[model samples]
Target: MARFNRKGTTKVLFVETIADPGYMPTATELGTAIDYSKALAATDGWSIENQEIETPDLASTFVAKIPGDDSAADSSLTFYEDDVDDDIETNLAKGTEGFLIWCRKGRTAGSKGMDVYPIRVASNSAQVSLDNEAAKILVKCSIIDRPLQNATVPTGP
Candidate 1:
Protein backbone atom coordinates (compact mmCIF):
# COMPACT_ATOMS: atom_id res chain seq x y z
CA MET A 1 0.00 0.00 0.00
CA ALA A 2 1.33 3.48 -0.87
CA ARG A 3 1.55 5.77 2.11
CA PHE A 4 0.07 9.22 2.13
CA ASN A 5 2.39 12.18 2.37
CA ARG A 6 0.40 13.44 5.31
CA LYS A 7 0.98 10.25 7.30
CA GLY A 8 -1.34 7.35 8.24
CA THR A 9 -3.33 7.75 5.06
CA THR A 10 -4.14 4.75 2.86
CA LYS A 11 -5.97 4.57 -0.45
CA VAL A 12 -8.31 1.57 -0.53
CA LEU A 13 -10.27 1.24 -3.76
CA PHE A 14 -12.08 -2.09 -3.51
CA VAL A 15 -13.46 -3.57 -6.79
CA GLU A 16 -15.92 -6.06 -5.39
CA THR A 17 -19.52 -6.54 -6.46
CA ILE A 18 -22.16 -4.48 -4.73
CA ALA A 19 -23.26 -7.75 -3.23
CA ASP A 20 -19.88 -7.91 -1.51
CA PRO A 21 -19.71 -4.29 -0.39
CA GLY A 22 -23.04 -5.09 1.37
CA TYR A 23 -24.75 -1.77 0.77
CA MET A 24 -24.75 0.89 -1.89
CA PRO A 25 -22.58 3.88 -1.27
CA THR A 26 -24.23 6.92 0.14
CA ALA A 27 -22.82 10.31 -0.77
CA THR A 28 -20.82 10.14 2.44
CA GLU A 29 -19.33 6.77 1.54
CA LEU A 30 -18.23 7.94 -1.87
CA GLY A 31 -16.60 10.99 -0.38
CA THR A 32 -14.65 8.89 2.10
CA ALA A 33 -13.24 6.47 -0.46
CA ILE A 34 -12.40 9.16 -2.98
CA ASP A 35 -10.81 11.40 -0.43
CA TYR A 36 -8.65 8.56 0.82
CA SER A 37 -7.28 7.80 -2.66
CA LYS A 38 -6.45 11.43 -3.37
CA ALA A 39 -4.68 11.68 -0.06
CA LEU A 40 -2.50 8.64 -0.75
CA ALA A 41 -1.69 9.66 -4.32
CA ALA A 42 -0.33 12.92 -2.97
CA THR A 43 2.58 10.96 -1.54
CA ASP A 44 4.36 8.93 -4.24
CA GLY A 45 1.52 9.27 -6.73
CA TRP A 46 -0.89 6.45 -7.52
CA SER A 47 0.44 3.76 -9.80
CA ILE A 48 -1.62 3.03 -12.93
CA GLU A 49 -4.83 1.23 -12.01
CA ASN A 50 -4.99 -2.63 -11.88
CA GLN A 51 -1.29 -2.85 -12.56
CA GLU A 52 1.66 -4.24 -10.64
CA ILE A 53 5.30 -3.24 -10.10
CA GLU A 54 8.24 -5.33 -8.99
CA THR A 55 11.80 -4.64 -7.65
CA PRO A 56 9.72 -3.30 -4.84
CA ASP A 57 6.48 -5.21 -5.21
CA LEU A 58 3.21 -3.31 -5.04
CA ALA A 59 -0.52 -3.74 -4.77
CA SER A 60 -2.75 -3.09 -7.79
CA THR A 61 -4.21 0.31 -8.61
CA PHE A 62 -7.83 0.94 -9.65
CA VAL A 63 -8.69 3.95 -11.78
CA ALA A 64 -11.64 6.10 -10.89
CA LYS A 65 -13.12 9.47 -11.67
CA ILE A 66 -15.00 10.87 -8.72
CA PRO A 67 -18.51 11.66 -9.88
CA GLY A 68 -18.87 15.39 -10.36
CA ASP A 69 -18.86 18.08 -12.95
CA ASP A 70 -17.10 17.20 -16.21
CA SER A 71 -14.08 19.21 -15.11
CA ALA A 72 -13.55 17.21 -11.92
CA ALA A 73 -12.03 13.89 -12.81
CA ASP A 74 -9.96 11.78 -10.40
CA SER A 75 -7.73 8.82 -11.16
CA SER A 76 -6.31 5.58 -9.75
CA LEU A 77 -7.29 3.21 -6.93
CA THR A 78 -5.25 0.75 -4.80
CA PHE A 79 -5.88 -2.96 -4.35
CA TYR A 80 -4.07 -5.88 -2.73
CA GLU A 81 -3.13 -9.10 -4.48
CA ASP A 82 -1.36 -12.45 -4.20
CA ASP A 83 1.00 -11.91 -7.12
CA VAL A 84 1.43 -9.74 -10.17
CA ASP A 85 -0.49 -12.09 -12.42
CA ASP A 86 -3.77 -12.16 -10.60
CA ASP A 87 -6.65 -10.90 -12.80
CA ILE A 88 -8.17 -7.79 -11.34
CA GLU A 89 -10.47 -7.28 -14.34
CA THR A 90 -13.58 -9.15 -13.18
CA ASN A 91 -13.55 -7.04 -10.09
CA LEU A 92 -13.74 -3.99 -12.33
CA ALA A 93 -16.60 -5.41 -14.36
CA LYS A 94 -18.83 -6.22 -11.41
CA GLY A 95 -21.85 -3.87 -11.32
CA THR A 96 -20.45 -0.90 -13.15
CA GLU A 97 -20.15 -2.03 -16.75
CA GLY A 98 -19.53 0.85 -19.13
CA PHE A 99 -19.32 3.26 -16.26
CA LEU A 100 -15.80 2.09 -15.40
CA ILE A 101 -12.98 -0.07 -16.62
CA TRP A 102 -10.09 -1.84 -14.92
CA CYS A 103 -6.79 -2.08 -16.71
CA ARG A 104 -4.82 -5.13 -15.53
CA LYS A 105 -1.12 -5.55 -16.27
CA GLY A 106 2.21 -6.05 -14.59
CA ARG A 107 5.33 -3.87 -14.70
CA THR A 108 8.43 -6.08 -14.58
CA ALA A 109 12.02 -5.02 -15.04
CA GLY A 110 15.03 -5.78 -12.94
CA SER A 111 18.70 -6.82 -13.03
CA LYS A 112 19.69 -8.73 -16.16
CA GLY A 113 19.24 -12.13 -14.55
CA MET A 114 16.17 -11.20 -12.57
CA ASP A 115 14.34 -9.61 -15.43
CA VAL A 116 12.77 -12.70 -16.93
CA TYR A 117 9.29 -12.80 -15.55
CA PRO A 118 6.68 -15.44 -16.16
CA ILE A 119 2.93 -15.06 -16.59
CA ARG A 120 1.54 -17.22 -13.79
CA VAL A 121 -2.18 -16.74 -14.08
CA ALA A 122 -3.86 -19.32 -16.29
CA SER A 123 -5.52 -17.96 -19.42
CA ASN A 124 -8.92 -19.23 -18.32
CA SER A 125 -8.61 -18.44 -14.64
CA ALA A 126 -11.17 -15.99 -13.40
CA GLN A 127 -10.33 -12.87 -11.44
CA VAL A 128 -12.75 -13.58 -8.63
CA SER A 129 -10.56 -16.49 -7.58
CA LEU A 130 -7.97 -13.97 -6.51
CA ASP A 131 -10.21 -12.00 -4.25
CA ASN A 132 -8.83 -10.81 -0.93
CA GLU A 133 -9.97 -13.90 0.95
CA ALA A 134 -8.23 -16.28 -1.43
CA ALA A 135 -5.14 -14.14 -1.78
CA LYS A 136 -4.90 -14.04 1.97
CA ILE A 137 -4.07 -17.73 1.82
CA LEU A 138 -1.30 -17.19 -0.72
CA VAL A 139 0.08 -14.34 1.30
CA LYS A 140 -0.04 -16.32 4.49
CA CYS A 141 1.76 -19.17 2.76
CA SER A 142 4.29 -16.69 1.36
CA ILE A 143 3.97 -18.20 -2.13
CA ILE A 144 2.84 -15.05 -3.88
CA ASP A 145 5.62 -12.91 -2.44
CA ARG A 146 8.40 -15.19 -3.60
CA PRO A 147 11.93 -13.84 -3.53
CA LEU A 148 12.62 -12.90 -7.12
CA GLN A 149 16.22 -11.73 -6.70
CA ASN A 150 17.04 -14.52 -4.34
CA ALA A 151 15.52 -17.14 -6.61
CA THR A 152 17.82 -16.24 -9.52
CA VAL A 153 21.05 -17.37 -7.90
CA PRO A 154 19.58 -20.55 -6.40
CA THR A 155 22.05 -20.91 -3.57
CA GLY A 156 20.45 -24.28 -2.76
CA PRO A 157 17.23 -24.59 -0.79
Candidate 2:
Protein backbone atom coordinates (compact mmCIF):
# COMPACT_ATOMS: atom_id res chain seq x y z
CA MET A 1 0.00 0.00 0.00
CA ALA A 2 1.23 3.51 -0.74
CA ARG A 3 1.54 6.15 1.98
CA PHE A 4 0.40 9.77 1.68
CA ASN A 5 1.01 12.99 3.55
CA ARG A 6 -1.95 14.54 5.38
CA LYS A 7 -1.47 17.96 3.83
CA GLY A 8 -1.61 17.81 0.06
CA THR A 9 -4.44 15.76 -1.34
CA THR A 10 -8.12 16.11 -2.14
CA LYS A 11 -10.29 16.53 0.96
CA VAL A 12 -14.02 16.38 1.20
CA LEU A 13 -16.18 17.00 4.29
CA PHE A 14 -18.88 14.53 3.48
CA VAL A 15 -22.03 15.18 5.47
CA GLU A 16 -20.17 17.85 7.42
CA THR A 17 -21.75 16.44 10.54
CA ILE A 18 -25.48 15.86 10.78
CA ALA A 19 -25.92 18.38 13.55
CA ASP A 20 -28.09 20.86 11.77
CA PRO A 21 -28.99 24.18 13.34
CA GLY A 22 -31.32 25.05 16.23
CA TYR A 23 -30.92 21.57 17.66
CA MET A 24 -28.41 18.93 16.69
CA PRO A 25 -30.43 16.41 14.76
CA THR A 26 -30.20 12.69 14.81
CA ALA A 27 -30.46 11.01 11.45
CA THR A 28 -34.09 10.34 12.21
CA GLU A 29 -34.54 13.88 13.40
CA LEU A 30 -32.98 15.06 10.21
CA GLY A 31 -35.57 13.08 8.31
CA THR A 32 -38.41 14.60 10.28
CA ALA A 33 -37.00 18.09 10.05
CA ILE A 34 -36.86 17.88 6.30
CA ASP A 35 -40.16 16.04 6.07
CA TYR A 36 -42.42 19.02 5.55
CA SER A 37 -39.93 20.74 3.31
CA LYS A 38 -39.33 17.70 1.14
CA ALA A 39 -43.04 17.22 0.81
CA LEU A 40 -43.39 20.79 -0.32
CA ALA A 41 -40.61 20.33 -2.81
CA ALA A 42 -41.81 16.90 -3.93
CA THR A 43 -42.16 18.19 -7.47
CA ASP A 44 -38.54 19.27 -7.51
CA GLY A 45 -37.32 16.63 -5.13
CA TRP A 46 -35.31 15.10 -7.94
CA SER A 47 -32.51 17.42 -6.94
CA ILE A 48 -32.40 15.85 -3.49
CA GLU A 49 -30.50 12.62 -3.09
CA ASN A 50 -32.14 11.17 0.00
CA GLN A 51 -30.80 7.75 0.93
CA GLU A 52 -30.30 7.42 4.66
CA ILE A 53 -28.96 4.77 7.03
CA GLU A 54 -28.25 4.48 10.74
CA THR A 55 -24.55 4.49 9.94
CA PRO A 56 -22.76 7.77 9.42
CA ASP A 57 -20.60 6.13 6.80
CA LEU A 58 -23.74 5.62 4.80
CA ALA A 59 -25.18 9.00 5.66
CA SER A 60 -23.69 10.94 2.78
CA THR A 61 -20.36 11.82 1.20
CA PHE A 62 -19.63 15.51 0.79
CA VAL A 63 -17.09 15.06 -1.98
CA ALA A 64 -13.99 17.30 -1.90
CA LYS A 65 -12.31 16.59 -5.17
CA ILE A 66 -9.08 18.06 -6.48
CA PRO A 67 -9.68 19.25 -10.02
CA GLY A 68 -7.37 17.37 -12.34
CA ASP A 69 -7.04 14.82 -15.09
CA ASP A 70 -6.19 11.94 -12.75
CA SER A 71 -7.98 11.29 -9.46
CA ALA A 72 -6.90 8.92 -6.59
CA ALA A 73 -3.79 7.70 -8.42
CA ASP A 74 -2.17 11.12 -8.18
CA SER A 75 -3.27 12.30 -4.75
CA SER A 76 -4.13 10.94 -1.30
CA LEU A 77 -6.13 12.47 1.57
CA THR A 78 -6.98 11.73 5.19
CA PHE A 79 -9.35 12.95 7.91
CA TYR A 80 -7.85 14.06 11.21
CA GLU A 81 -10.04 13.59 14.28
CA ASP A 82 -12.58 13.27 11.53
CA ASP A 83 -14.83 11.36 13.81
CA VAL A 84 -17.27 13.16 16.09
CA ASP A 85 -19.04 10.27 17.74
CA ASP A 86 -21.37 10.53 20.71
CA ASP A 87 -18.65 10.00 23.28
CA ILE A 88 -16.50 12.71 21.83
CA GLU A 89 -18.93 15.13 20.21
CA THR A 90 -21.07 15.54 23.31
CA ASN A 91 -18.54 14.54 25.92
CA LEU A 92 -15.70 16.48 24.28
CA ALA A 93 -12.10 15.32 24.08
CA LYS A 94 -8.58 16.50 24.90
CA GLY A 95 -7.17 17.11 21.38
CA THR A 96 -10.24 17.41 19.21
CA GLU A 97 -12.25 20.56 18.60
CA GLY A 98 -14.58 20.28 15.66
CA PHE A 99 -12.76 18.18 13.01
CA LEU A 100 -9.56 18.10 11.00
CA ILE A 101 -8.57 16.83 7.56
CA TRP A 102 -5.07 16.17 6.21
CA CYS A 103 -3.88 15.92 2.65
CA ARG A 104 -0.78 14.48 1.09
CA LYS A 105 2.02 17.02 0.80
CA GLY A 106 1.99 16.85 -2.98
CA ARG A 107 -0.06 15.97 -6.01
CA THR A 108 0.04 12.96 -8.36
CA ALA A 109 -0.26 12.81 -12.08
CA GLY A 110 -1.98 9.45 -12.06
CA SER A 111 -4.86 9.98 -9.59
CA LYS A 112 -6.03 11.83 -6.52
CA GLY A 113 -8.28 10.40 -3.82
CA MET A 114 -9.63 10.91 -0.31
CA ASP A 115 -9.68 8.45 2.57
CA VAL A 116 -12.62 8.43 4.97
CA TYR A 117 -12.29 8.10 8.72
CA PRO A 118 -15.38 6.57 10.26
CA ILE A 119 -17.31 8.66 12.76
CA ARG A 120 -19.45 6.44 14.93
CA VAL A 121 -22.10 8.68 16.39
CA ALA A 122 -23.11 6.83 19.53
CA SER A 123 -26.34 8.69 20.27
CA ASN A 124 -28.57 11.46 19.07
CA SER A 125 -28.18 13.87 21.92
CA ALA A 126 -24.52 13.24 22.49
CA GLN A 127 -23.40 12.95 18.89
CA VAL A 128 -25.49 15.66 17.34
CA SER A 129 -25.06 19.41 17.78
CA LEU A 130 -27.15 21.58 15.52
CA ASP A 131 -27.49 25.20 14.40
CA ASN A 132 -24.93 27.92 14.87
CA GLU A 133 -23.97 26.31 18.12
CA ALA A 134 -22.85 23.22 16.29
CA ALA A 135 -19.11 22.81 16.32
CA LYS A 136 -17.54 24.85 13.54
CA ILE A 137 -14.94 22.79 11.71
CA LEU A 138 -12.07 24.03 9.60
CA VAL A 139 -10.98 21.51 6.96
CA LYS A 140 -7.49 22.15 5.58
CA CYS A 141 -6.52 20.27 2.45
CA SER A 142 -4.52 20.93 -0.70
CA ILE A 143 -3.45 19.52 -4.07
CA ILE A 144 0.27 20.03 -4.64
CA ASP A 145 1.41 18.68 -7.96
CA ARG A 146 4.72 19.32 -9.63
CA PRO A 147 4.11 21.74 -12.46
CA LEU A 148 3.13 19.78 -15.52
CA GLN A 149 6.33 20.09 -17.53
CA ASN A 150 4.52 19.62 -20.80
CA ALA A 151 1.00 20.72 -19.94
CA THR A 152 0.11 24.31 -20.61
CA VAL A 153 1.96 26.42 -18.01
CA PRO A 154 0.33 29.82 -17.98
CA THR A 155 2.57 32.43 -16.40
CA GLY A 156 2.84 36.24 -16.38
CA PRO A 157 5.95 37.24 -18.33
Winning candidate number (lDDT):
2
**CA displacement after TM-score superposition, residue 33 of candidate 1 (Å):** 10
| Total backbone collisions for each predicted model | 3, 24
Residue ranges of candidate 1 with Cα displaced over 4 Å: 1-8, 15-70, 77-85, 93-157
Model 2, CA-based lDDT: 0.25
lDDT of 1 by residue, 2-88 (tens): 322423322233322122122333223223221222212221122222232323224446544343322211232333433664434
TM-score of 2: 0.16
Encode model 2's per-residue lDDT on 35-110: one tens digit a residue: 1111111111101122333323444685433433432122212112224343323322322222111112222222
